[model samples]
Structures are given as C-alpha cells and as structure tokens.
Target: MPAEDDFTVTPYAVEGDVDYDRLLEQFGADALTDDQRAAFPDPVHPLVRREVFYAGRDVDAFLDAANAGETHSVVTGRGPSGPMHVGHVFPFYFAKYLQDRTGALVYVPVSDDEKYLLKDESVGAISDHARENLLDILAVGFDPERTRIVVDTADADVVYPLAVTFAKDVTQATVNATYGDPVNVGLSFYPAVQAAHLLLPQLVEGRHPTLVPVAVDQDPHVRVCRDVAAKRRYDVDKPGALLSKFLPSLDGPGKMSSSADAPGILLSDDREAVFEKVRTRAYSGGRSSVEAHRRRGGNPDVDVSYLLLYYFFEESDERVERLAREYREGSLLSGELKEIAAETVADFLEAHQERRASLGPLEAELPKFRLAEAERRNARRRAGFPDDSLAQQ
Candidate 1:
C-alpha cells in the first residue's frame, strides 16, 4: 500500500493527538469518526483528522502557516512494486485534491526501493513501462506539473554513495532503538535515502518542500527524518508530515493488494471484473438473512468492503449514514447494504480506470536545476560531510 509503511523514509514526526470529531465535522461523513479515532493511542491520534487527515510534529505548525498562505511544499510517495491498485487511488486522489486546493508545490516519489524488498521482481526489466505506468498514475487527474514522481532506484544508484556515507554516521544503537531488530539492515538504509529524497528539491538551491503527506504506518520513517534534521549536520530538509490510514482493501483492513500477485482493481480494471469482484470477494459485515440483520443490525466495524466504499466514494455521505442508521436501528438488511456498498465501490474503480486511460504527461517539466541540484546536494554528502542520525521526537 502506498500509504502504509513502518519506515520507508526518515525524520519521524513527533506523534500527537488528532481531533477526529472535528475532522468528521469538517469532512462530514467522509472522515473517520471519533470512535475510530480513539482506536489509536496518543501520538497516533491527530494523524487522521478530517481537515489534515494525519498529523505529526510538523503538522500543526505547518498547517497553521499554510492556512495563512505560506509557500511550504508537501511530499507524498508511491511504491513502484506493482501496478497501482484500487486502494492506491485514495492518496493520489487526495494528493491531487490537496495540491489543487492549496496550491502548494507537491513532490511525489515513486518508491522503487520498497518494491525491491517487497517483491521478487527488479525494476530494471520494467524500464520501458515506467512512462506508461506513470502515465496511468497521471490519468488519475492531479495537475500534471504540480507533482514530481522520481524513479527512485535509478536515482538511488547515483545517490547511494551519499546514502552509504550518511548511513555510516548513524550508530547501531540509534538504528536499533528506532527499529527493534538489528537484522534488518537493508530497511534501515532505506530511511536515509528517503530522507535524501525529501531534501532533493531543496538541494537544487531554490525549492524546498517542507511537508510530507503519507499514510500512518509510514510515521516511523518520517520521525527519523525529523530527528536527524534537528541535528542539522547534513543539508537534509526536515519535512513535517501529514498521514492518512491505509485505504482498507476489498478483502481486509490494510491497503488492497492483489492476493495472487496479479492485477488488482487496477486504476484500469474493467466494469465486468469490477462488479464480479465487488459482489463476490469484497468484505461484508452484514448477517446471513433479513430477519437476522433486523435483530442484530449490520456490523460496520469489521465490515471491510463497506469501509472500502466509505473511503473512496464522493457520494457516500447519505448512503453510508443511512446504512449506519439502519444498522443501529436494527432495521437494515446486511445483504442489501452489501449490494449497495459493492455498487458504490465498483463504480469508483470503474471511474478511475476511465480517467486513467485519458490522462497526459506532465505539463510543466521539472526545472533542470532541480535534478542537478539534487545530484550536487548528494555529491556534497559523499565529500565527507558528517552524517547526523534520527532520534525519537
């Protein structure tokens, strides 16, 4: 899932409480409720607020400034492990919306590294498909020039020497403290590289994206970035982070990944396939029969499929509220609700596929200086600059 990760980047956001009720009020029925908000403890709280979606140390302060029209930038990422899935749409769509509404410079990283570890395949074989894959991502309809998606592995080869130099500066205790296991060295190295990517726009001399928006599981990684940035030994940009939860999969609680490693509800899945999957495989919390449902109501908490629609559809307000009302009143039938939820989810996936097929390449090309600057910024690190490591915020 694009939004869910334990530690793919660095500079962890100091965790804090989020005002979920206000989020639901701000986002209306579209946001998570107070009940769900309480499910996550302290630092996890504010990360999923309605307006901000997710929060961390830099979240509140940056947002305060952003509302005043400050020129801060935000970064979000995508893992190039496989074809983007239905669940992947939420963050991209969300990112597109945030950029359009706020007019902030957005930096998007196509995280090929995570895929290197998560999947059996290498990205090199898919080189030709990179443009095609990104075109599909663009098809989802965010402003073409407002965002940047770097093919991380390609950049990594050029950036790794600096990454290694930075890694050497972090001690085993710091690494072990943040990540409990000492065996996962590769995962540890990824955070630093991601931290470097966070500062890439800044390294070029003019652009500095100060905020990063990602899913909640990824908070650990950003916390590392924040921790390291405080020390200021390197030229790394310490970005504030806003997080969102994994868009629950059709089958379960996390991001929807294809079970057999084939295509999922692609930003390209066809109508027939969409309906078939939604009706047959999507998670359902409704009971077996109408009478049983009337007596017990539908179970929304464990209902994965409905939640899928809840997170994706724009028209969800009335239907979901009504469904919830019926369930609570013991007058709703689970089967019927599931059918509606299936339709809602299927329609969303179908629409995404259409939009994706019609999209174009980036309109405003990235400034050449941006890439060169990132190169030089990394080059400086390779020239024996002291590395500062992440600590808990």
Candidate 2:
C-alpha cells in the first residue's frame, strides 16, 4: 500500500499452493497450540515473542507487554508469489483493526526472493509481481506514510553491501533451529537478513521506526531479531512485534496447502472461476443430508465456507450468526456459501484491480522505499558494524 503509485509495482495474479477442499480432507477439525494462540495478540518483552515463535512455546509475559503499549508497529509481509489470494487477504484485514484503532505503523515486506524458491516464477516476473502486491496492500486502506515497504529483490546499491555483511553475524545453527534446512550456503544467511530487517530502520538516523506483522508460523524471524537487538549489534534499532493468524482454507483446520487439489480463492481468479471453485470445490462442513444437518447445529469452527465469510466477507457478527444458523438448519447449502465467497472475493479483486493498475510501480517505489536514504543509512550501519546481517538468494 505504501508504494501504490510506484511504476515498478505490478498486479500479482498469482495462485495458491493447494486447494481448500483437499486441505480439509487432509487435516480436520483441530485447534492451535498454546504458543500459536498467544501469538494471536502482540507480545511483550520485545524479543520475547520471537523466542516463543522460534521455540514453538507460549509466553504470557509477552502478551502482557503488548497490552501496555498505546501504539505499536503492525507488520505483515508477502513473497510476491503471484496475485494475492484469500489466504493473503484475511491477515491484512485483521491488521486494519490495529492500524485504525491505534494509528500504528505497519511495514509490508515484499519477500519475492522467498517466493521465487516457493513458486519458481521467473525472477524478473516475480520482482514485477511483488510491486503489484504492494498496491493491493495499499488499497486495503493501510496508512501509506505510516507504512514502510521493503522489496528484498529490488536492485539497489548500499543495501547489497550491508545485507551481505550482516549475514555473517548470524550463525548456521541459529538460523537452522528456526528456518530448518537451507537450500544452499546462500540461503543460510536468511536469519541475519531477517534480523537486520527487523531493526534496520532505527539505524537510519531518523525518527521513523518499525513494527513487524509476521505470520504465527514465521515467528522464528522475530526471535532472531530479538536476539540480535539484545546483542546490541545493530545498536540503534528497537522494534516492536505484532502477530496474526493465517486464515485456514475452506477445507477445514490446519494449513490449506497451495499444492492440494481443492478450491482456493486466488487473487487473479475471475468472477466465473471463483464462483465455480466455490460451488464445487470450497469445503463446507455441512451435513450430506439436509435433515441430519438441521438436527444438529453446524460447527462454525470447522465449517470452511463460513470461516471464509467470518474472515473475509466483512459481515457483522449478527449477520454471520444468522448465516451460520441457516447453514446448521440445512436451509443454507454449500452452493449458497460458495456463491457468497465468489461474489465477495471477485468484487474486492475487480474493484482493487483498476485502482492498483493506475498506481504504477515506480510511483510507488520511488517515494516509499526511500532507496537513496535507505542505501545511504545502510552504508553507515555497515561501515563500523561487523558482517553479521547478510543473506543471499
């Protein structure tokens, strides 16, 4: 969103990794761990959240810290894998609440480098797609001035010198403990890159600050940041953390992989395609028979279609409840739910598409990224600092 007018930006009409329906079949009604649940809110003790995220443990102490702040950074990011999808929407939607209520700063990191590995899109195309995703993020109404957009794949000067040097600061085990196996030596420095990203802005010698909005699944990066911050390695940066839940697919609980053969609401998907996917593929935990469903109330927690509505359709609590009741009574069918998702999703995409297209990449990139400043400041940070924050593609 911060780079809405950038000419370098483009629309990402990307696809999801799996379908909703199959993910539901593969993993059924389940709940999150205590740590994951805690991550639903901002954490206290700056580095504490990351510790919990990396350890896969929960810390009530961290949550208590988040509650004390009047404002905090709301961080969310993307790999620019392609056009956005429902999987991407819900997080930003939730982030809006914090952004509005507290008037907090939000940083949207476009991790197209990570996406390149995950999706195999050509580097040039993925780089372009990453910019498009930023505009879409802006249209969601995030405050541009208060938001910072970092494109890891962008061609820049000072950043390259600092980032590579920073990589050496983080060790292989530390990154591996959280990120798991790296694809190669180049990949091993990911944690350092992540660590620097979390705190780099403070090193800018300006008043601007940072807050991170990482998925609960990506908590490890925060942990690494906290560790580096404590080490006083970066010296100037002090970052806050906000966490969000990843919306499950219509399939059910657990990760709805982009690889599975189920319905996924892709950002690029059109009205008809979305409708068809919803009608036939979106998983609904409704009864096979109307009478049986009516006899027992439906599980809102498990109903994939309703969850989509809860997270994305933007309906009121009462309205959502009414819809749930109808679904339980068998008065509402899967087709009906699918139809709603299709219409709502398409409407959002179509409306945003035009506004985004008008916001060229350079318009967005030139102003928002502060390339000259970031590079200048980065040079200073790396001048005296050790080579501990580098990560290669």
Candidate 3:
C-alpha cells in the first residue's frame, strides 16, 4: 500500500483517486499538447480529440513517422484474467482506428502467463479466459495482414526467448521500485515479458517507431521497457506511449470500470442488460427530489451516465454539448440522461455483438492474424537468440 498522501498506480493495483497531472510529473511524461493531438491522422479518434487520452512519451516520433509514410506500429495488449469489458476493449478499438487511417501495424499480445502468476486462478482457468478474450479481440476487425496476435504462453517459443534477452537488462531493484515486491519469481520476471510485447514489432518488422496506448497507471511498464531499449542490447527504438484516464466505474469517479465488483457494460451485454445496469447501477448527480433537481440542475462531471456518453458512446459533439447544457439548466433529468446513455451504449454493443457472432471458429480465424513463420524467426534472431533456439521437437 502507498502512504496516505501518495497514491499507488501499477499494472496490477491502482489505489487512491489518481491525480493524473501529478502522476505525469512524478513519472516524467509530458502532457499531450494541442499540437501533438493535431498531428494524429485526420479525423482524430474521439478518445484522443476529447482528451480521454491526455498524456504521452515520445509521441512526436510516432506522429512524424506516421505523417511521413514511414513504418510504425501500435502495441496494445490484454491480460485475460476474466471476461472482456468495455473498458478493456477501448484501447483495442482506438488502435484499430489508428490502423484504419494511418495504415499502422497493430500487435495485440495476450498475457495469460502473467495473469496466472498474479491471480489465484489455475492455469486451466487462465487459459480458458485467454481463448475467450482472443475471440473478443478478433471481433474488433483489424486487418489480418497488418495485425498480429501473440499469446505469451502459446507463442512462448518466440515470446520467451525475447523476454529472456530483455530480462537481462531489467534489474530486480528497478522492477521492485516500479511494480512492488512480487510474491514469486514468475511475477518478478513478468516485466520482461511485457518489454517483449512492446518491442516485438520492431524485432519482427525491423526497427521502426511504435506507440503503446494504455491507461496512465500502466506507463511504468513502458518506462521499464524504454530503459531496456536504451541499454542498446537490441537494435530497436524505445516504444512510445499514449496514456489515458480511467473509464469511471458505474458507481462513480475514483473507481475504475474494470473493478470486479463494478457492474461494467461488457461487450457481451444485451440491450436489456445494458439498460438495467445504467438505470440502476450508474451513479447520478441530481438533487434528492425531482423538484429540487428541476431547480438545481445536475452535475454532469460526476454523473456516470453522462460520462458514458461523453467518453465514447456519443459521437456528435453538438448533441453532447446540448445534453450537458440541458442537464445543467435542469431540462434533462437524471433518469432521462441515463436512458439516453443506455440507448447509445446498447446500440453500440448491438453492432459489435453482430460482428462477433458473424465470425467463424476461433481455430480457423486466428491463423490469419498469427505471426508468420519468418516473422517469428526474425524476431527471435533480433532478440539475441541463435536461429535454432526454441527449435521444434
């Protein structure tokens, strides 16, 4: 646990109401400037344009490569400890948006090994979740030729050797300082696996700019990988990062939507389920009485329903502004706002679920997105391993 005034933010645990600005200061990352936002490919993602993604490290190098038509990649990954939720999928969707516009290669890594080592779950249970999570990720509709999905345990032949090479550069003291004391050696060495995920594209495709978009708490992982790249053990550029604010839990601010107890709008949720969760679970900012609310107006800043619409659901800026104005002036009641958010969310989920249902079996669909044989060999060789290391039995 962190001290009273100091908050703890790490890959596993996030406590205290994170002061994002203070975090950037402490971590030495720069805030995403207006100029940097403009540099993103035209028709910027709502996540970026709206400042949901607010800070970054070495983002300029990525934008420069993107605009100049040079090679670049985006690495955003998942830890399949449980079901995939809206919060978990946002970065994948954001990455897809960039891939669609900028033609950037996207690498999606699923870390089942790390989840098993960290969580109480058995390997069997973790593997189940990883398979299910992979299906959801594939439903995001990334271009198969341009996207690669690597599972740490399943792709260990390539992933493990790269992790071993990078692990040599990451000291235990550095890991302790960044991630806290680990209960076991596997947890201790998971950072090396993460470093491999971020650097894999460069290793496979040759040195090029790569950007990792993740929540702010996850920046330390990127920093650790950057430090390893700085050691010049491999011919790779330090991966850049775009850090974002947490999607507020339905209960309210200070709680992340990813919390196990929180009733998140899962990608698998139906329309009725979405409506029920928003109407009942979403925290409101209205006065106690209807008359009081009519007179006092609601605070959209603290309203989870309003935030749902603002964060990703609502695409029209004018409509969002109007809703806020109405809510502030008392024309939009809390229930009405909740209903609007619910409908918007349900509509979005319907489309996503339809696409997911349309997909073929995971065994058949995944091959198109898996790294090719030559790419795997190249990545292993570039990560300082012999050509025959991890050779097939």
Candidate 4:
C-alpha cells in the first residue's frame, strides 16, 4: 500500500489514495462550476449532477455549443485489450445521456493498435477483443446517424493518414513526458493517432466544440491532443475534457479492472453471476459484528456496493440518498445494500444484454455507424491530404 499522499495517476497506472482535487491542479484543469453544471442540458446526468465528472478543460465551450444547437460532439472511446466491464461502460452511457438530451454527435474510437503495442497479446487475439468490445459499444444503442465508430486497425486508411498528418507536429519528447517513456516506437507514435481520433469530428465536418469524457487518469491523452490542436496545424478545436473519478473496484477504492487477475463484473455476466460477485467480493464498510454495526452505523463513502449505486446503477437521487442515509444510520445492513446494488446492476446488465442479443450480425449493423466515404475523404483532405493525394488514391 502507498502512503496517503503517495498516489500516482498516469495513463498506464493508478495507485494509492487519489486526491481528485489535487489532480485538477496538477493537470491544469478547472473544476466544473455550478453555473457550468446548470448550463448542461436539462435533466442533467447523474454522473455530471453528482459530480462523478468533477473537473474539466474548456467544458463551458462544449456546453455552449451544445446549448446553441450547433455541431457539438462527444468523443469517448475504448481500448479493446480485454473484456468490457462495468467501469468501462460509464463514459459511453454518459455520452449517450448527453446525446439523447442535446443531439451531440458521438465518436467512438477503438484503439486496437495501441492495445497491441501495450499488451503481449497477438494481433489475432487483439482483433477478437476488438470485435467483442465493439458489440458492447454497439449495444449501448447510440443513434447510427449521429454516431461514428472508428477502429484504428480496421480504419487505418483514414486513421493512419490523419495520424501521419498530426505525427509531424508531435515530438518524441512530448510523448515521453506525457506517457513516461513508452515501451516501443508504436506506443511513442500513438499520441498522434489519438490526436487524429480527438480531431476526427472537426476534420470530417468542420471545427466544432468536441468534449472527451474520460477517467481523470486519461486526462494526459486529452492534454497531449490539446497540445497538438494548439499547434494550429489543422483546423480543429482543442478537444475539451470531462474528467471522472475512478469507479471503485469491487474489492476497494481503486480503479476497477477487467483483466484476468482482478476480474471485474464483465458485461457478459448474467444476473446470477452479478449477484454472486457482489455478495462475495464487494468490499463493505460495516462493523465486524451485527450488534456493533447496529449501534455505530456504517460508512457508505468507502463501501463499494454503495459507491456502485451512487456512481451509475441507481439513477434516482432521492433513492440513493435514502439508501445512504439508511446505511449511515445503521438501519441498512451492508448485505442489504449489496443486494440492492446487485439487483439494480443486474437490471441494467440484463437490459444491455437484451440489446446485445437483439442486434443483428456485426457486419450488418456496423456499416451504418462506420464513417461514410465522403466523411472519410473530408477528414483526409482536411488533414493536409488533397483529394488527388496518393494516400487518398
């Protein structure tokens, strides 16, 4: 265990007790002020309203464009290194919430290429994971017309050329400083690809306010891309960022993981599996003895079950507040709280699974969400490649 002030949060690793407020200062981001929060589309998402997405960079501009009924966008993506987990789905759901409310264009970028560089997995294995991850993303039910999904390996024709255009402006020193000496040349060059992903909406349509909803640890990626956008090499806005707290791991207060070792609640888990995991593995904040718990109450703040509900599962503020009050007052047992979280999470998963099952073949369903030919052409053209460029051919 690390000392209280010894936490390290980077794109590759997060450890110790994360001081979220301190992170905002270190990353040079602003906390979302109340007025900025109010400016979000009405029926504000619980994630935003409850301050799960606590800090941001240039958030007001994105909200401003969104409010004005302009071409605003939300770029939230996945790196398909493994199975999708509850923690991994938060941003997509949050983006969907904003899209439903404000018609924000959504861009889902799958970084299969980056995952291949970072992980020991074979290309085939990574491709398999990408296919599975894409299904979960598709199951989120983003509007096809308003959403575009880009797979780095699959869409390299466009992604690569755009990345190449940005690569010229990104230096190895910047990549090393941002990501702490990437392991390979591919990793070193990925920031440029990420810049392409961040600027894709602008490169395809036109310069517009784009917001990236991500875990605070991933803010470095946004910062790096912001630097690239600041260079003025391309006609694009510096993508704004909305940073979120890590969802508590099932065992404790750390970022959740879906790797084989840590084993998170997978998107494929059924209701029975969800309940069993919550009952058996969820970290609790109750007293050691029943009598002691009844006398002293519990701490919901550190309880994984309660935090899960507070973070995403339970949507109602009143209900979640009541549950917390009951727990803190000792009227609610940790077991009961786990049960509620299990049921709520299971309900959510079942709905998601139903959507996943109802979808047709990936080939049939994915075409509508993939970038159209003209959009791809425009992106390449805006990235300094002309229509007659060899890359375009």
State the lDDT of candidate 4 residue by residue for 9-67, as single tens digits. 98889977789988887889999999988898888888988999999999988998999
Candidate 1 achieves a global lDDT of: 0.56
- Mind sharing the TM-score for model 3? 0.97
C-alpha lDDT (0 to 100) for residue 15 of candidate 3:
73
* Candidate achieving the largest TM-score: 4
Model 2 scores a C-alpha lDDT of 0.55
Decreasing lDDT order of the candidates: 4, 3, 1, 2
lDDT (0 to 1) per candidate: 0.56, 0.55, 0.90, 0.92
After the best TM-score superposition of candidate 1, give how far the Cα of residue 46 lies from its true spot, in angstroms.
15
Candidate 3, residues 82-121: lDDT per residue as tens digits?
Answer: 8888888889999999899989999999999999998899
TM-score of each: 0.73, 0.71, 0.97, 0.98
Better structure of 1 and 3 per lDDT = 3
Best lDDT goes to which candidate?
Answer: 4
- lDDT tens digits, residue span 177-248, model 2: 556667666557666666545554554433233555544445567666666666555554445444434466
lDDT of 1 by residue, 1-393 (tens): 113323232222212223333423322223434643443322332224332354344554445445566665667777665566766656666566556656666666776665565456666744434555665666666564555556666665435654565565566666666655543567667777766656554543343447666665566666666666656665644677656655656665555565573225666666677667666666667777767777777777567656655565534366766767776666766556566765776677666667755554444332321344344544444434323322101
- For residue 72, model 1's alpha carbon misses the true position, in angstroms, by 1.4
